[model samples]
Target: MIEGLEPWAQQGLGAATGLAIGLLVGLERGFKLRRQKEGKRVAGVRTFSLLGLGAGLAGVVAETQPIAAAVILLAMLGYLAIAYAPRLTSGGDATSPVAAAVTVVAAFLAGLGNVGLAGAAAAILVFILALKDEIHQFVDRLEERDIHAIARYGIIALAVLPFLPNEEMGPYGAWNPTKLWWVVIIVTGFSFAGYVANRLFGARHGTIATALIGGAYSSTAVTQSLAQRLGQTKGGGAEPAGIALASAVMYLRVIVLVAILANRILLPFVILLAPALIVAWVAGWWLYRQAEPSDAPAPPGNPIALVPALGFVVFIAIAAVAARWAQGQFGEQGIAILLFLMGSMDVDASIVTAGGLPPDLIGAELAAIAIGGTIIANMAVKIGVTLAYARRNGWSAALALLASTLVLAGSIAVAWLRL
Candidate 1:
C-alpha cells in the first residue's frame, strides 16, 4: 500500500487542497466584487486557483534561492496591474487590491499547512470573505460613540496605564497608581460583563443579578427600580420574593467587594457566614418556589459607566492612604474604625484591601467583621427603602419581601448552629 503511493502523491495532494481552497475563496471574492454594484470582473474561481498554485510553486522554488520568492511576488503584482489597467481609471480605493492579494496568499498558505494551523486558515478566510457585505454594512452602521469607546479603551491600556507612577503617595502612603488602576480595571471590567449578562440572561435568572449590578452602580437606583416595578404590577407571592432576592444579593455584593479589598476580614466572614449565606440563599430559592411563578419583571438597573470608574479609582486610592495611616496611628483598632465606616458607604473596598494584610500590620479579622456588620446594616436600609416604596407605590409586596428577609436572617443565624 505504501509502495503504490508515489513521491509525487504528496505534492499532488497539496496542489489539490490548494486548488479547492482557492476556488472557494475566489468565488467569495467574486461575490464581494458584484456587491460593489460593479459589472463582473476577470478574477474569479479559476483565476484565484491558478494564482494560488503559481504562488505555491514559487514558494517551493524560493527554498533554493531566498530572493527568488520576492522576485516572483513582485512579478505577480505586475501581472495584477496589467490585468486591471483599464479598470484602474474607475477603480477607486474601494477596489481594495490589498484585500484580494491577502485572500490569495491565505488560500495558498492553507495548502502548505498540513501540520500546524495551516489549511484551517484558508477555510476561515473563505468564511470571512463571504461576510464582506455584512462586514461592510456593520462598519457603516457603527456610530461615533462606538468608535469613541474602542479608542478610549485603547488609550487607557496603551497610553495611561503604561505611564502611571508606581510610587506610594499621601498620608496612609500605601497607594500605588498602577495598583489602584488595576482595582479600577477590575471594577470597570464588570460593567461590560454585567451588561452582557443582563442582555443575554434577562430577568429570568431573578432580580439578583440586577441587585448586584445595581449595588455596583447605585443601590439607591436599585431601590427606585424595585419600587417602580412594584407600582406597575399587582402584589403577588413573587413580588415579595423579588425584594428578598435583591436584598440577599446585597450581601453577596458586599462580600465580593470585601474579597477583593480586605481578604483577612473576608476570610472569617466567609468562614462564619458561608453556611448561613448558603442556607439563606437556598431558603430564599425555596421561598421563591413556594410563591406562584409570575414572569419576573425586567430588572431595573444600569452598569457603572466611565465617570464612575474614575471616581472608584480615586476613592480606592484615598482608602489605601487611610489604611496606611490607620496601620501606624490606629494600630489594630484603626482597621476596625476604617472598615466600620467604609464598609457601609461601600463595603467591598475596605474589606478587599485588608486581605493578606498582616495581623500586626492591620486587623484582618476586624475588617471582615466590619464588612458583615455593614451588610447587616444595609439590610435594614433596604427594608426601610422597600417599605417606603411600598407605601408610595401601594404595593404591600415589599412588606412580605421584608418579612421574608427577616426570616432568612433568622435562618442564617440558625444555619450557623453547628458551625
Candidate 2:
C-alpha cells in the first residue's frame, strides 16, 4: 500500500493524520462545551475541523512556497486572538481560545511529517483536560518538600548527569563517572516512583500497599520501618505480612535489574531464584490474609537526598574497584567472596559491579553466583531487621523470610554443583 503512493499522496496521508488528531481533540472540546449556550461556546467541532484543514493545506503549500505557510499560521493566530478578544471583554472564559490555539499548532506539526509527536501531544492534552479534578486534587496534596524533591531530581538527572565524564577512571578502570551516575539515576528514579505511589495510595490502601510499593526503593528499609511500626502496636499480623511481601518484592526487583543489565545471566538467575520468589509471594499473601487491616504511613523524607546519592556513588565505586582488584589478585574465587561480603550492606552495588564485569575476566555463570550470594546476604539482613524491631510479631515474618531464602540458597547450591 505504501509503495503505490506518489509524493503528493504521501503528503496527503500525513495531512490526513493531522486532520484526524484535530477532529479527535475537537470532538472532546465540543462535548465539553455541549451544555453551554451556542454563542457562549468559543470554538466547536466545525471550527476546529476547519482550522486543522487550513493548517494542513498550508503545509502542502509550504513545499513550494514557505512564505505562504508563514502567512497562514499568522492569520490563524490573528483570527483566534480577534475572536477571543470580544469574549474576554464580555467576561467569557479564556480556556477555549487557548485550547484552539494549541490545536492549530499541533495540527500544523502533524502535517509537517511529525504525526507521531502531534498525535501523542494531542492525546496527552486531552487526557490532562479530562483529569482536571484529579490533577487539582494531586496538586492540593503536594507538600513543599515534594516540590523540592522534584527539583532535586531534575538537577541530578538533567543538570549534573550530562556534565559527568563518560570515560573510565580510577583503579582497574573500575570507575566511570557517567555509568555510576546512571546507576544513581535508576535507584533514585525507582525510589521517587515509590514515593509517589505511597503518597497517592498508602493511607487508603494500608500496610500491604506501602510494603509492596516501598520494596522497589529499599526492601530492607521497608522491613526495618514496618518492624519498628509493629513494635509500637499491640500484636496484629500486619507487620509480618508487610515484611514478607516487601522481601518477596525485592527478589522480583533483582530479577528485573539482572534482566536489564546482565540479560545473558538473567535466564539462569531466574531459573534458580523464581521458585523462591513465588513461594515468598504466596506465603506473604497468606500472611496478609491472616492480618487485621492496618494503615502504614508513608516513609518520611525525600527519596533522592544528595547525601544518599553521594554515598551510593562512593559505595559503587568502592565495590567496582574491589571486585576488579579481587579478580585480578585471586581470580573468580576472590570476586565471589567479595560479592558475599558486599551483599550484607548493598546488594545493588554488587549486582551492578558483577553485571559490569568484563566477560574475559569473569564469565556469566560466576557473575550469577556472585549475584546469588548477594541475594542470600541481603535476605539475611532483612531477617535480622525483622527480629530486631518487630519483636512481638517478628517470629512469623522472620520464619517466612527464612523459608524463602533457604529455597533460593538451595537452588543456588544445585546450580553451583552443576557448574
Candidate 3:
C-alpha cells in the first residue's frame, strides 16, 4: 500500500505542476484578450487553464486503470467540442483552431510530464504564439505565383527527389540527378528570398531597385521585363529615357555575378563598375523622371522560375561532357575557351561545368573569367533583343545602354584577371 501510494503521490505532483505552468501562461493571455475584446476564434485563458488542469487530472486517474477506455472517453469529448464549435462561434475567426491546438498540446504535455518528459514546452509554445500575427501577415503577403514556386520546391523534395537514381549517370560518371536537384533547390530558395525582398523593399523604390532584385531571379529576365515596361509611352510614343534608367540597374547586376562566382576578384570589378552604374543611374533616373507616365504597369519577367529542375539537369550533363573534353584536348585554356563560349548560351551551364573541372585543368580565376565572359555575351544578346522588341528603339538610349554594359563587362573581366 505504501509503494502504490508513493507512485500516486509522485504522479499527482507532476500533474499539478503541469497544470500550474499551463494556467500561468493561459492567464496572461486571457487577461490581455479580455482587456482588448478583440475577437479571434479562440477560447480565452480560463478555458485553456481548465482544459490543462482537467487533462492532468485525467492522466493521473488513467495510470491505475484502462488507458484505452480513458482515451476513448477523451476522444468523444474532443469530437463533441469540435463539432459544436462552428455553431457556438458566431463571429468565428481563423484562430479558433489554434486555441484548440493549444488545448491538445497542454493535454499531451500533462501525459508526457507524468512520464518525466516535456521540459519547458510551455515556454516555447508561448514564444511561438506571440509571433503569430507577424507570421500570418508574412504568409498573407506571399504572391500566388510565389506560392506555386514553393509548391514546386516541395514536389522536387518530396516526390521527384527521392525516386531519382543517386548514382552518377552517363559515360564518365560525371552527372547525378540528385546533386542537380540539390542545386535546383538552392537556386529556388534564393529566388524566393529575392522575390520576397523585392516585394517588400522595391515596391516604390524605382526601376533601378526592381532590376537589382529581378537580376537575382535572372538578369536576362530582368532585362526583358524592364525594357518592355519602360517602353510603354504616353499617347503614341514610347519612353526611351525610362528604359535607359532601368539599364543602370542591369550594369550593377552584371558586376554582381563576378562577386557571386569569385569574390576575391570583385574588388577591381566593383570599383570600375560602380562609377558607370552610378552614372547611368543618375542619367537614366533624370530621363525616366522626365518621360515616365504616372500610371505605369509593372515589368513583365517572372521574379521566380520554379528552379527548372530538369533544365538544370540537362545543363549539368552537357557541361560535364564539355568540361571533360576541354580538359583532355586543350588543357585549362581550352576549358576556359569552352566556358567563355558556352556561357553565352547559358551562364549557369558554363559555371557548373567550370566548377567541376579538375583542379589541374583550370585555375579558379580562369574559370571565373570564362563565366564572366559568358555574362558579357549574354548582355549583347539582351541588348539585341531589346532593340528589336522595344517600341522606342533609337540611337541615343541604345548608345548609353551599350556603353554601360561594356563598362560592366570590363569591370567583371578585370576582376577575374587580377587584384
Query: Candidate 3: deviation at residue 209, Å?
Result: 5.4
Looking at model 1, residue 79 earns an lDDT score of: 74
Q: Pick the candidate with the highest lDDT.
A: 2
| lDDT tens readout by residue for model 3, 1-419 | 11445765766765675566557667656754666546642556666666566666665566565585378437735863775477467654444345445545555456534333433566666666666787787787777876776776677566777777888777667777776676566555555666666665555565555655655656556556655654553222224454555555555554554455445545544565575677667666665555434333353444344445666667778777877876788888888898887778877666556555556777766665666677568667767756665645444456656776677676665665573
Question: TM per model?
Answer: 0.61, 0.92, 0.64
Q: What is candidate 2's local distance difference test score?
A: 0.82
Candidate lDDT scores, in order, read 0.58, 0.82, 0.60
- At residue 300, what lDDT does model 2 achieve? 40
Candidate 1: count the clashes: 14
- RMSD, every candidate, angstroms: 7.6, 2.4, 7.7
Q: Write the per-residue lDDT of candidate 1 for residues 1-419, one digit (tens) a residue.
A: 12465645645555566566667667777766666544447576667777766655554444566587668667776677776766666765534355457545654453343512335666777767677777786677555655665565555545577788888766646667887776666555544455434434445455555554444434545666666666666555354555555555555655676566555566666764565456446645654675655554554534444676677777776776777677778676676677667767765565545652556775444555555555656666766776676655423434544454455455435533433
Pairs in steric clash, model 3? 41-96
Models sorted by lDDT, best on top:
2, 3, 1
Model 2, residue pairs in steric clash = none
Pick by lDDT: 2 or 3, better one: 2
Give the per-residue lDDT of model 2 (tens digit) for 150-244.
88888878888888999988998888899888888887887798788777777578888888888877788889888888877776758799999
Q: List ranges where model 1 is wrong by over 4 Å.
A: 1-159, 200-220, 237-239, 249-266, 290-302, 355-359, 392-419
